[model samples]
Target: MAHKKLQRFQEIKTFPNVFEMPENMAQRWTKHFNNQHPLVLELACGKGEYTVGLARLYPENNYIGVDIKGNRIWRGALTALNEDLHNVAFLRTPIEQIQQYFFPNSVDAIWITFPDPQLRLSKAKKRLTHPRFLRLYQQILQPNGVVYLKTDSPNLYQFTKTVINLFGLELLQDYDNLYAATNLLPEHTIKTHYEQLDIAQSNRIHFLAFKLNQTLPIEKDVELKKLIEIHGTD
Candidate 1:
């Protein structure tokens, strides 16, 4: 089924090296956007379900779906093109190097959906909500930018909650089972492909939202050298 999906959307807009985006391209992007629009980024954005949906729902805001898989992002890119959506874009890249592409305080919000938990203790730094990645997110996000996360892993949810609390960040919402929540906005409650599958299987879906406060203390960087010594370089 995943293979068929990839085959269907093969000929769509895709970047070969999203992380190494040129400085000139950045200038061009700034010129194209004129710095007047709000930018939302969806990290590890698979097929860009949220990105396309947001483009349709909030035409005033611009959305970018960042992911490493070209085939996965093709569907979202094609959707934007087919719909003539001027507010959406797609970038194919590893999420870890996101800071290389976006300017500081350029992003207004972020959506993270169904990311791998990287469950090994030694791989903690590779997690999207880890201190290192959070630092990168802080560099790109606006002062009051919000982050939304949806995942099926209870461990990831607990780890993220702990990290947020430890850093004194505010948690807007934390639900172990999102479908059970009656208060979510209709727009905010839409599920992604993976999310819908999980729901159909009677699996609990976790979700959380939090604001980025510039005043909060950033956590100390994890020692990558030590991590490497313990886990070896992958």
Candidate 2:
């Protein structure tokens, strides 16, 4: 199984712990690439298609793929290691706990690919773009940094768009059909594993890109906490 494969990879090399104090992040991260490069994170990076592809595309930036499932991220980590890619790394942790790891304004950008929709109304807080996660991202992402979401779920696409609009944040792009347009740049045209699967099946891919507006007045944190407590029970 995938989990077993990940466990094997974990045994080979212990991943650095990012959940430590903020002062430690630079030491840990910079040890690999130093401070001159920008940092990018891929949340819920399943199989690491985007992480690997992007790292290949942007050698000047450092890429880190964060996911709780070690098995899921093993492919990405191994690929980076095998390719001797100095600019890409993998972090094994829950995406919700991301704020506890990085310092304020530390990351330059974020890519969220095929995240779960958490479709039920009661499960809204669990969505990656929900206010709680957004706040966490704000704490780590640089002021002008952006978050990119690519998925096949229409509900999630609409829900995230609505949230961005309600919060008065800028929506740079809302592509309901990304591949239909002819002007796609090479950087944007590279596909993830899931995206490739979808393409082969002739399915439309939805994408949203938005910048982080630090000045926006976010609602109380208690709302998300309450939602998590009420709906997160297994």
Candidate 3:
């Protein structure tokens, strides 16, 4: 297993569809994809399921899955190559440094699918929907761009709702139980490995779609933390 992982890590470096902590790519996605189509990102995209899936679904838009695990990325990158998914790519890097890879207003949309909930109060800042990451997302996302969060953790689902309410973000859609909804989109039905594992045991998928139309003030984070401290104990 160890040797195979090492081999995958080394092999991905050569895959034309994979970029590992590359430099000077902030404004070059269009050039790399050789088109002006909209660019969407799936952060922490383990195995690039959503990346390859979305690319297959929406051939017009480009998709890039961002994750730190080169070994895991090999699976999706190879699959995309085999299927000739020209619109799919994988970026091996931490989500925190996402801004470094794309220029301001370059990304059209972001999908946070079944990410780590960071349930601890102390680690709240690490949550993808936390203000810290939201600030980074705002830097790279277009003004009209939207963010989609799909998770099985009830805690994360509610936590994100609190952030949206407190930050005054526009909540475009919210479904506590996505599969239970009468109206469902094809993209929403794309399930990841984590989602299949049912690790949370919540027995339901939560989905939230919101726009960062309002500013998320740094001072507001203090209030956000306080709220988490109060209700987080449960």
What TM-score would every model get versus the actual structure?
A: 0.81, 0.83, 0.98
The candidate that achieves the highest lDDT relative to the unseen native structure: 3
Of the pair 1 and 2, which is ahead by lDDT? 2
Task: Give the alpha carbon lDDT tens digit for every residue of 1-234 in model 1.
Answer: 887766644555343212223454544555655556888999988888988898888888988889887777877777777888877887766877788778788889999987877867767778897767887888889888998888887767877777676567789988988878888775567667877666334378889899767343542344433443454322
Q: What is the C-alpha lDDT profile of model 2 across 144-231, one tens digit per residue? A: 9999998877767777776676567789888988878776766567677777665324377778999879454546444434543554
- Distance from true location, Cα of 31 in model 2, Å: 1.7
Q: What lDDT score goes with residue 126 in model 1?
A: 84
Best by TM-score: 3
Which portions of model 1 miss their true places by more than 4 Å?
1-10, 13-23, 33-35, 199-202, 214-234
Q: What is the lDDT of candidate 3?
A: 0.93
Please give, for residues 1-234, the per-residue lDDT of candidate 3 as tens digits: 999999999999899999999999877788879998999999999988888989999999999999999999999999999999999999999998999999899899999999989888888888999999999999999999999999999999989999999999999999999999999989999988989999999999999999999999999999988887787721
Better of 2 and 3 by TM-score: 3
The RMSD of every model to the true structure, in order and in angstroms, is 5.3, 5.0, 1.1
Which rank order by TM-score, best down to worst? 3, 2, 1
- Cα-based lDDT for every prediction: 0.74, 0.75, 0.93
lDDT for position 175 in model 3 = 99
